[model samples]
Target chain A: MTLFDYIADRWDRLALQSWLHVSEVVQSTLLAAVLGVLIGVAVYRSPVGSAVATGLASTILTIPSFALLGLLIPVFGLGPTPAVVALVLYALLPITRNTIVGLAGVDPAVTDAAKGIGMGRLAVLTRVELRLAWPAILAGMRVATQMLMGIAVIAAYAKGPGLGGEVFSGLTRAGSANATNQALAGTLGVVVLALLLEGVYFFIARFTVSRGIRG
Target chain B: MSDVDVTGLSSEPGLKRADRVRLLAQPLAVLVVVGAVLVWAFARETDEIEAESIQAGVLLTKTWEHLLITVVVTAIVVGVAVPLGAMLTRRWAKPVAPVFLGIANIGQAAPALGVLVLFFLWTGWEGLWAAALPIAFYSLLPVLRNTIVGIQSVDPSLVDAARGIGMSPRSVLLRVEMPLALPMVLAGIRTSLVLAVGTATLAFFVNGGGLGELVDTGYKLNRPAVLVVGAVLAVGLALVVDWLGALAEQLLGPKGLG
Candidate 1:
């Protein structure tokens, strides 16, 4: 049978796998964004806190994905819990860094004026600083989404829900007839998902960034 | 001046001793712990598998294989990407740069494993080149982009001055542009080096020998100790490479620039 034929045969299963991948990515991305932004906010006031936060996030990148999953396996067992945890950890650096950057880029003069007008610190942050920094924060989210998309494939190593299982099994069984097709579908799903997420991010940027800034 | 500016200005460039200790000590502690674990695993494993001389050499073989892929991939990526990036920045070739970059973006967008798997399936074989080729493809983007950005960001006045001093266009590019671009280009290479180190472990999946074999065996045999050791070594190697890269970047950059 042709590759498409095999794909057609496996459509339901593939769709379910694709859904799992997307859901996990969404769950992990949201969690990372919330946690990252909070951490960024907490640390943005102090240079030491900022440096430590950034340093810690970046250090997470040094761990190999394969080994990370393997290490987690003993503790978390074979499932999405460990997979999501790893994804969140990997996603933290970009989002946190971006949040810090965005918040930092807010003009001190603007905040001063807001303060002069009797706006409280919390009010200034919510109404002005974060508003101004929204674009950069969103950019970070976009990057995190893209990265997590690629990483979600590795999540399948821990049997986390995703299209990676198909890819992994097909890869190991490359000598078989339909193995390439299976792998192709899985890989194609991943790439397509990445592109689609990127498109969503573009649309988001267009609508969300202040019109003056866009100009 | 505002209170914030006053406070910020009060801190000297020289880090406090406490800050220095915190900066160096934390990562060093992690390294020490990781090292202790690996040594323990190696010693224990030796006692368990003493009969197999080849088995004993797993550490040596894996490290060697890991280095081979890292070196070959880094060489190929640097060789191709640096020149291609330079070529793209030329006046006539500027328009085509994005097209090439877009292609690179797609390569990066795809999972590294997916790229490797494709290459392996296409070649119907697995070994050094089979793995290295795809990794090079995946890693080419950062260096290429950095080189272009670096060249373009070179001070126009400096180029004009070179011309003013009777340097040929070729000389201007060779002497002025490249030297100035060195830091950014090196930064890009550093990024790729870290990437190559992490990705090289995946080489085991494609039948390319590396420390990943130890990882895989450890996983399959339920030996968490070996798995942890294999992983720590790979990660440790990445950190070491990153440090070395930073050193190179600092030293290789134009003297006054740093």
Candidate 2:
């Protein structure tokens, strides 16, 4: 069958799968951003704590996606649970590291001035330091998002959702009719999705970062 | 002759002898821990397999094969990225550099597995080079960008001084620019090497034969021991490779800038 024919035949299912893929990426990245930021904030205040946090995340980053997914299968017993877990763990390094750098990078004088204005710790953090650090944090999330887009493909090995399953299925069916098409479609889907996300990030960055600091 | 203050030029933070030893021991510690795990695991799994000899061979051969793929690919990436990167940074090539960088960015942006599988399918020739070539392509970005950045960031006055002494452009680049860029170039290589180690595992998909086969098969067969051992070994190898890069950085990074 021609590639177009295959897509036509599989369009509905492909659409569902594509949606699943995007949702999975969104859920995973959001969760990772939250947790990674918390970890960064918790540790960034102390040099030793930041070091340990960075070290732990870096160690986790070294583990191959294939192996990490494989290792998780038995523990999490496959499907989205293990896939999301591994993605979260993998995503942590960039986000956490970026968070620590971003927050700590806020000018001390700026923060002190904010504090001197009677802004409580929470107000200053939420309104001042975090605002200055938002761009860096977003940049980290971007890296994590892109990294996981590739990695989530491996999640298919654990029976997780995403275009990866389609690709893996095509790979396993390699000499079969239209298998290459299937694989190509899946691979293209992932790359396009990743680029689109980047586009979205650019849009967000334009609006989210204040004009003063956009430079 | 570079007069770059090679002393104190080194950016690696100074370390006491004891601290250096402790840092260096990290991989050794990983080795010990992994060895113990292997013993316990193999001891437990001996009952499942027919012969101890086969398991040992499988482990060693897979590891060697994986290392071979990684090294060959990373070397190829360095060979290509450095020279190509240098050329793009040349005066005549300024306008075209962004195009090359964009291509490199796509190579990096594409999922590595997709790149590998796509190449495998296109070539339809399974084995080392087929897999190695695509991975090398994927990993070329870091070295290329670092080489460009390193060269561009070199002190212009030094290049000027060399040229003032009647040195050829090539001589000036080799003597002044390249040396200044060495640290960043090496750093790029280090990143590529670490990435290559991780990406090599997917070579199994193309039937190029590597540690991934062990992990993949172990998973399919529900042999957790084989899976764990394979995963641990890959992680260990990655850590070892990363440490080696760090060591190279420490020893070879601009010297005497201390």
Candidate 3:
């Protein structure tokens, strides 16, 4: 088949709404990103929490993704829960590190000034620091999102949803060539998602920085 | 440099070693608490595979073979990626760099296991090249990107000065740009090396030689001891690689560290 035919075939899967695989990928990504961001923010607010989370995330990053999924299965059971948990674990390092680094990057002077003007702690954080830190923080999110996009495909081992199903099915069928199409499709889908997410982050990061401070 | 001068330049807080330990304070304590809890959780599991009869001597030989594989793959990755990255950063490389980068990203995203499976089937699973090809693919992006960035980030003035001194382009690159880019390039090498080590663990799943045998064994039998041993060794290796990178940065001195 021509390359256009291949792309057209994949794009058509997106149109059908019958592509349970695409939906699974989106769901897994959203779940992982949201959880990662929330946990990342929590770690940012507390030093003890940051240290513990960093160590845990460091340890998790060391674990092979499939093996981690295998370990998660008995505890979380088959399907999205285990996979989501694994993705979230995989994502923590980038997001949490970025959150901490971004927050730390915010100038102490600016925060003190806001507080001097009687801004509350949360107000100072939200208005002054977070605004300034948004670009770096977004960069972190971009990294995590991209990393998660790639890893979600591997979550198929746990019977979790995604294009991994096609790849795995192709493998099991013993048609390595046939598997290539699925693997290729899955890879293309991930790259598209990564580029889109990175582009969005750049747009948002630029906007946030322009609005928050002078260059 | 005198110890006092070094101490003045270091941005770390002026705490003695004893004070640093003491100030480990609550964060260190919390880490210990969380670690203990995780150990308990992992230990609670009972069902697992019976221990395999692979002798310790055999396991050691296998580990040595795996390390050799990792080193060879890493060297090949660096050999290709560093030069390629330098070439990509040149004015002429603009068109091709993005394409290479896109391919690298896809390689990073796609499951290497699938790639390994495909290669094994295609090449009849004949030799170590089956494992090396996928790993070299994995190592490419970091090594390449870092090389480009590191070279590009070199102070323009340094390059100009080297040129003004009538040095050839090659000598300028080696003496000026590379020295400046060494730390960043080293960081990329470190990332690829650690990644190679981790990915090599997956090699065992494909019956390629490596410490992955232990990890795969643990996975198959659900044996926590073996799993723990495998996981710990893998993590330790990663940490050691990272430390080695840090050491390299330090040894290259302040200019490279920057």
Candidate 4:
């Protein structure tokens, strides 16, 4: 059978699971973003400390995910939890780097005015610095979300959830066209997911920055 | 005289340098501390595992092989990507650059394992070209995007001035614009190189080369030593590339003329 015919034949069976998998993957991204923000904020507060934290988080990125999963098996063990954690560790660098860069990129003149007007430190950060850094911080989130979407599938390699199962299954069967079709389909799903998430975050970024800043 | 003329006093450059040095110390110390801890932990693990000849060779030879494969693939990638990128940057070629880069981003988003599997089937792991195929494509997008951006971002007036001086378009591009655009292009190369190194290790799944041998061996047999050794070597490769890229950028100078 032709590749399209093969995929068409399997579509009914694959549809429900793909939908469920995409939902779980979406949830995973949200969880990662919330956790990542906490990590980013913690790292940003201290001057010397942020550098050390940034290095450590980035070094974590270099470690192979499978190896990390194996290492973590002793602690978190075999499921979405470990997978999400691994994805989060990998996601931290782009998010935190951008946060630091964005916060630092704020205009010093605006910061001076805020301080001169007797705003508290927290007020300066929330009302002034963060507002200016919104676009950059959003850009960072866009990158992180895109990265995690692909990674979530690879998390499937360790037997976690999402479309990677199809891809991995295809590899095991040794040249079956059905398997090949499935793998390609799953990969397409991931690309679509990535683009959708990117568009959403981009729109949100525009809204946030526009509303937060005067001009 | 009584006002002390504070505005005329120069700031201390030495003190400024000292303060910068102090600011950098904590991060350097943290990196050293982390490296030492990782080494100690791995050493302890290695001691627990009985070493064999293959394992012994894996520690040294595999790393060298992985590095070799990584360099070869990256060189091939740069060779193809630079010309393609340059061609895509021309005004007439503008619309098509995104099509190429979009395909590249898809290539990137596709997990390395998936590509390796697909390539393995498409070309039965029987030759070097099979391994090079996916890696070269995977590294293309950043190089291509950076080249287009780098070239297009060049000061238009500078190109005009070179033209005004009667330099050939080729000479202007080669001597004037290319040098000016080199830093951004190099930045893309740096990213591509580090990524190729990490991704090349995934080639172990298809028995392609070097450090991935350790990665595969460790995973299949549950040997942490091989895995750690492989991973450490991979990371060390990235660090070396990063440092080398930094050195190249510095030597090339902020001017990019070098």
Candidate 5:
């Protein structure tokens, strides 16, 4: 069967998998961003703290995703839990590092000006520093999201949601009718979704970046 | 897979305290963690199935296969990407450089596992070449990109000076541009190395036997010891390789550049 015909035949199931794939990745990216930004905030003030935080996060990145899944399977059991945990861990480095880099990149003079204007420390941070650092933090999120897309595919090994199942099922059914189509659909679906997310991020940056700082 | 320097190897150029600590501590940590895991796995009681997969001979062979795939893939990536990147940076090749990078960016977006399985299906091939080929494609972007960026970032005035001194273009490229670009190229290679090692774990999916096979075997057969051993060993190997890459970056770059 032609690839187009194959996709058409399984359009509903393919659509659901695509949604689940994006959903899982988006949720994981958001979760990592929250945790990463907090870590970045906590550590950015101290050089040593920033180094340690980024160091540990990058070490996690070095671990192969499959191995990490294997390590987690025993602890988290199969399904989305292990998958999500692995995705979050993988996403942390970029977000946290960027958060640190972004926050640190903010000019001390700007913070001092806010202080001189009678803003409290919390107000200075929330109103000024974070706004200025939003672009870098968003860039980090962008990187993490792109990365988690591929990883969520691997997470399918643990019976995690999304297009990865199609790839694995296709692998198992190799040499059979429609196997190639199945794998191609899954693979291409991810690439397409990743591109789509890239657009989403573009719009997000457009709308969310403070007007004065938009680039 | 656009090969971000996830490991932060290039984040700080000089030997800061953190770099020194990591340089001394990473391999030591790998040794301790991997050794402890191996000892625990062997010391534990096991069923026949677990014992079969967890034997020293079996573990060693699997680790060897995993390293072999990583090495082969890294070699192919460096060989292909370095020259390709260098060519793309040439004045005549500039117009098409983005085209190559665009293709690579899309390739990077395609999942590594997808790339591997698709390659296996397309070629009807298996074993090392099957695994190595697709992975090389997946990991090539980093080195290729860095090579172009490295060469392009060279100061034009430096090139002008070399030309004014009667140096040939080829010699200028060899002695001037390349040495200056070495650190970036090496940093890119390190990222590719880590990627190749990580992706090599999936080689077993294509019958290219590696540490991942043990992972699959353990997962399939319900043997946590086997699974942990496989996972830990793969993790350990990647750390060691990354550490080695960092060391090379520190030692191999041309002097006086830092």
Candidate 6:
């Protein structure tokens, strides 16, 4: 069968896989963003704290996804639990580092102005600092999403939902007539989804970024 | 400040206190963790299945395979990307640099496992080359992008100064541009090395045996000890490799720049 014919036949299954893939990645990215922003806020004021946070995050990033999954499987067992945990851990580094960088990059003068205007410290932070740092935080989410899209495939080996199942099935079913098509579908599906999300990020930046601070 | 910088390449001029602490701590941590894991695994009473895969010789071979794949992939990435990046940054090649980078960026977006599996099926080749080639492709972007950025970031006045001093274009490139770019290039290579080591774990899927084989063996046979050992060792190896990359970045760059 032609590649197109194969995809057409499996369109329903493929579509479901694609949705699951995007859903998990988006969920993980959002979770990481919330936690990361908190960590960034807590640590951005102190140089030592910032260094430690980024250092720890980067070290986590250095661990292989497969290994991390392997380690998690023993504790979490084989399912989406292990998958999500692994994804969250992997997603943490980028989001956390970016959050710290973004918050630190915020001008103290702006915070001072907010204070002069009778804003409380929390108000200054939530209204002024995080607002200004939003772009950087969003960019971090974008990167984390792109990364998790690929990684979610590996997570599929642990029985996580996604197109990676197709790839694994293809590997196991090598030499079958449809194996190539299955793997190609999974691989290409990821690339396409990644590109689509890239566009979504562009639109997000356009709409969400304040005009005054937009660059 | 591009996608490459997402890896958090250190652009600081000199080793700071934190860098020093991390440099000393990373390898030491890896050693302690790996050593403790090995001792624990060995000290455990293993059944036949666990014993089969968790033997000393077997672990060593798997680790060697993993290291070999990492080394081979790193070699290819450096050899291909550095020269190509340098070429792309030249005056005549400037227009097409973005094209190359664009292609690589898309390549990066693809899953590493997909790349490895796809390459395996495409060529009908198995083992080391199958694993290394696609991984090299996957990890190439960091170094390639860094090299171009590194060379392009060189101040034009420095080049002009070199030329005015009667230095040949070749010497100017070899001496001034390359030395200035070395730190960036090395930082890129460090990122690439970490990436290569991490991805090499997937090499087992293509029958290119690595620590991942141990992971597979443990998972398939339901041996938690074997599985944890495999996972920890892989993590330990990556940390050590990254530490070495950090060391190289510290030591290998032109001394005057630091």
User: Scoring model 2 with DockQ, what do you get?
Assistant: 0.32
- Leading candidate by lDDT: 5
lDDT of 1 by residue, B31-129 (tens): 796679756765663535322322447777888898899999999999999999989988999789999999988888888888888788767878888
**In candidate 3, what are the lDDT values of residues A1-215, reduced to their tens digit?**
64356657766663332245445544554565566556666666666565565555554564556556656666686787877888777766655555555676677898889999999988997788767766655565566666666566667766877666655565555544445555455555555656666677667666667453635
Instruction: Please tell me the TM-score of chain B in candidate 6 relative to the true structure's chain B.
Output: 0.95
Residues B210-250 of candidate 5: C-alpha lDDT, one tens digit per residue: 99999989999988889999999999999999899989988
User: What is every candidate's C-alpha DockQ against the true complex, given to 2 decimals?
Assistant: 0.35, 0.32, 0.29, 0.23, 0.60, 0.62
TM-score of each: 0.91, 0.92, 0.76, 0.82, 0.97, 0.97
Better of 1 and 6 by DockQ: 6
Shift of residue B233 alpha carbon in model 3, Å: 3.6
lDDT of 5: 0.90
lDDT by residue (B1-258, candidate 6, tens digit) is 223255654664221444666788788889899999999999989889888887899999999999999999999999999999988988899889999999888778889999999999889999999999999999999999889888889999999999999999789888999999999899999999998999999999999999998888889988889989999999999999999998898889999876
Error of 4 at B202 (Å): 1.2
Kindly list the per-residue Cα lDDT of model 2 for residues A78-187, writing each as its tens digit: 79999999989988877887787788778899989998989999999889988888888888888888888888888888899989888888888877787788887888
**Model 4 lDDT tens row, B52-105:** 413445466776766676778778878888888888877788788889888877
Top TM-score: which candidate number? Answer: 5
- Model 2 clash tally, residue pairs: 8
Predicted candidate 1: interface RMSD?
8.4
* iRMS values for every prediction: 8.4, 8.3, 9.5, 13.2, 3.3, 2.4
Q: Give the distance in Å from residue B179's predicted Cα in candidate 5 to where it truly belongs.
A: 0.5
Between prediction 1 and prediction 3, the one with superior TM-score is 1
* Model 4 bad stretches (over 4 Å): A1-32, A39-50, A64-70, A73-75, A112-119, A210-215, B1-50, B126-128, B253-258
Report chain A TM-scores, every model: 0.95, 0.97, 0.81, 0.85, 0.99, 0.99
The candidate that achieves the highest DockQ relative to the unseen native structure: 6
How many clashes (backbone N, Cα, C below 3 Å) per candidate?
Answer: 0, 8, 1, 0, 0, 0
